[model samples]
Target chain A: MPAIEVEGLTVRYGDLVAVDRLDLRAEAGRILALLGPNGAGKTSTVETLEGYRRRAGGKVAVLGLDPARDHAALTRRVGVMLQRGGVYPGMGPAEALSLWAAFYPRPLDPAGLLERVGLSAVTRTPWRRLSGGEQQRLSLALALVGRPEVVFLDEPTAGVDVKGRQVIRSVIAELRDEGVCVVLTTHQLEEVERLADRVVIVDRGRVVADGTPAELVTRGAGRSIRFGAPAGIDVAGLAARLGAPVNEVDPGEYEVGAAASPATVAALTAWLAERDLPLADLRAGRERLEDVFLRLTATGGAGDGGQR
Target chain B: MSSSPAASARQPGATPPSAARQLTRALAAQTAAEARLTLRRGESVLLTLAIPVGLLVFFSVVHVLPLPAGVRRPVQFLAPGILALAVMSTAMVSLGIATGFERQYLVLKRLGSTPLGRPTLLAAKTLAVLAVEVLQVAVLSGVALALGWRPGGDPAAALGAVLLATAAFSGIGLTMAGTLRAEVTLAAANGLYLILLLVGGMVFPLSHLPGALADVARALPSAALSGALHASLTGGGPGGGVESWAVLAGWAVLAPVVAAFTFRWE
Candidate 1:
């Protein structure tokens, strides 16, 4: 059964529609990445799912409870790491964990949880004394304190450095392995590509694309191919010779799409061999999720008269 | 949603902590945490304990007011008034300023997101304030006694007066803190404290005020609280009776309700 289900969700801040009609579902033990740009209502959607905001219109269920109606119950079952939260100045990181533990029925031991977030060494350091990355790690611990079945992480690694980012990804991955439904929202394309099992792309308050990473990139977003032609060879002539639709996205950089991968590679290699063209640098691969997001969002914005 | 041992404790046939016990334990833990933080912060500690002591000593030693004929020394009259000010200062100013900063820091929002509901949070805060106020009253009473001041009325009534004053001022303080910005709350709390101290008979008798200001002072919670304290402590002067109690009670009840409605978690 799905851990979360939202049907026709609409949320607005004043006259600005933050989340246009949207639908999404995340099954238990799966990582669903809600990807969107800033101001794309990612926070609003996450907040709504966390029962932090009231939806203008929608039918929503989190852990089989209506978020708007059973907010306290849902909150207990679902853990959330908000983008920014209040930290008391006097409470050390360890003390904060202890206090939060008191609120839950059964919580992770403070030491173990601290170690999990890499905050064990600074357990006694006040929150204000921690570095930015350390504070983010502490916030992650708080989200996991309740041993919640579903965790909602909103930009969990926004300001984190490379190592910290990897730690966050590992933590999310571990949570999923533990049978917790992880709804990860981030603008980091690489993080989504690395961690998400399913991708939900939202733009301007609507879901523009949703599928597995490979499926979305392969199906609609075009692929890229780069190869070296003879020094005197014409790039456009190479495109015609290869018998495939191609475009020079940049000087010396070309992108192409074909129905069959092996056939396309063979055709390109054969064409090069026939011309005694040494393929100095050859590159071919499926389209990236970033390209898919940018193209879909860019196309929509352009179609809507560029207001976006 | 996983059920553990605690879940079994909440099952239909299992025993649960009584409501009173739960409230007590929660209130105790909350109060202790708040109090520890309140004490560790130098600024709040000064505001809570030092300010009251300083005002008491300055007014008692500086001879700020001339005593009426046949009345005891100025310290006798000023001591009870200072006690009322202490309660007002701690409950209203200290609570207001602290809560404002707490709100600004999103501490209240974070707490609310937990199982610690608003009522428990309020109870905890009130208890913390009261604990400080209790120490304030005890220390002030001891100092005043050393200065040869003695209450000339019913002992229980004087204690009752102190308790009432604390309750009333705390309500007003929490209300103002919950409703205003930290900067605005700090300013308003200090400004209101001074206004009440001067006009509401903390430093001198309301009888000494001009007719119009004295009338306003009579309605002020600080004045009512001071008046009640004075009537009990000095056992001489215009007795506050039920009217003063009512004024203080009005503030105590009304402030918190308004605060609850207006407070922002963040």
Candidate 2:
């Protein structure tokens, strides 16, 4: 059995349907990154699998135990790192870590874990006083303290500095080597590319794509041109002129996730030149995960563009 | 698939202690941590310790308020009411408002995910409240003693009244914190403190009010607790021991049950 499995999961808050029949599976010894735009129901899906949410309908099992029905048993094996502010403001990381460690039968050493997370210097610093990077590291430390088989991290590197990112990345890579199942949700595609073994993109409460990072990168494998321009550019007009689908993957960032021959590049540049638009960063390569992501979920999604 | 080779090698859940043992260990550890957190906070110390003592000392010496009929010393009547106020402050005003903010700040929400489940968390918070209540009672009684106020009546009953009143006020506090927004709970807790002090007869005598209002005031959780404590300490008076204990017990049970049903994690 997969370490984490959700079959036809459905979650609703009052009248609004947050998650609708979503299914996912993550294997042991690998990191699966769940990605989505804001309000795309990623939190609802992750929280339901963690047993914090009561699903409207569907079956979710972590380690073969029903998350909602067998929550108490599941919690023993599952560790959750909330998106923000779980530690008490008044408590220092040292005291807090030791207290949380007492919950598990045999937890990792709090002091060693602190050092591993690069938090030895600020052991006595209260949670509120710690920088955002330090706090995220502490949260990661707490999540790992239990030595849990399955760990759910919400935006582990959202506001982290480069050193903090390196620390988190190394710890996560180590978890996979130890055969732990790591599930995370984040917006940083670079982190996903560097850390995630499998990538699952969720949009409108469903999985739009699920595969290994390499598989996803090459799934739509082809020569493509990516560039940065002012946001709200007429993607439809550009696609018609260049005969390649153009999407604003992020605000003011565009991706052309398709065949981009010499003609297409000249056409794109000419189109910009006619409007006196200075082309920002430009790249010609195989479809990256970001291009695939934007292709799968753009301003409208699949079947939402002009040519190619 | 079974767990990873490395994970399975650690003898996961193999030699763990019994469930009861783990829970007991968690409870003790959490309580100690909570106590430290509670005491270190300036606001917590001020609410749970300083203000109650300040009210008791100020009222006993100032002699500004009129005494109830048949009451000889100001400390005799004011001591019981002020003690009840202390419990209310710790249970509802101090702890309850903090818990409401805890919900907003993700303290309670994050803790909920751990093996130290909601019941254990609630128990830890309650024990912390009781610890503060114990300190408040000791300091208040000491102040009352030095004020030349003779405390007579049922010592055992006074202790019982304190415990029951703590339960009742904590139930009220949790109810507000779990359901309402933190800011609203903060405002409401302080507002309720003042309301109870005036109307619950903790400061003013119940008899001073109109008959219907006095009857209602006597039945509130605050009034019931103070009345029961006063009756116990004074050896017998209009504080009305037996019925007040029953009223407090009722609140102690009903309010928490309601809170258990209504509370939202975040």
> Which candidate number has the best TM-score?
1
What lDDT is obtained when candidate 2 is compared to the true structure? 0.85
True-structure lDDT of candidate 1: 0.76
Clashes of 1: 1
**What ranges in model 1 sit over 4 Å off?**
A221-233, A257-261, A271-285, A302-308, B1-26, B66-70, B155-168, B236-239
Best by DockQ, which number?
2
Predicted structure 2: clash tally: 1
Model 2 lDDT, residue B133, Cα: 83
Q: Which portion of correct inter-chain contacts appears in model 2?
A: 0.62
Displacement of residue B228 (Cα, Å) in model 1 is 1.6
Q: Which candidate gets the maximum lDDT versus the true structure? A: 2
Question: For every model shown, what is its TM-score relative to the native structure?
Answer: 0.88, 0.87
Residue B11 C-alpha lDDT in model 1: 29
Q: Give Cα-based local distance difference scores for all models.
A: 0.76, 0.85
Expressed as tens digits, the lDDT of each residue in A1-308 for candidate 1 is 69999988999989999998889999888999998778888888988887778999988889889887887666556777777656677778888887776666556777777876787689988887887788888888888877788998888898998888877887888777667899988889998888999999888888878888988777552355755444445656666876777665565555564544677778877877887777766666656788778877774464522221
lDDT of 2 at A222: 49
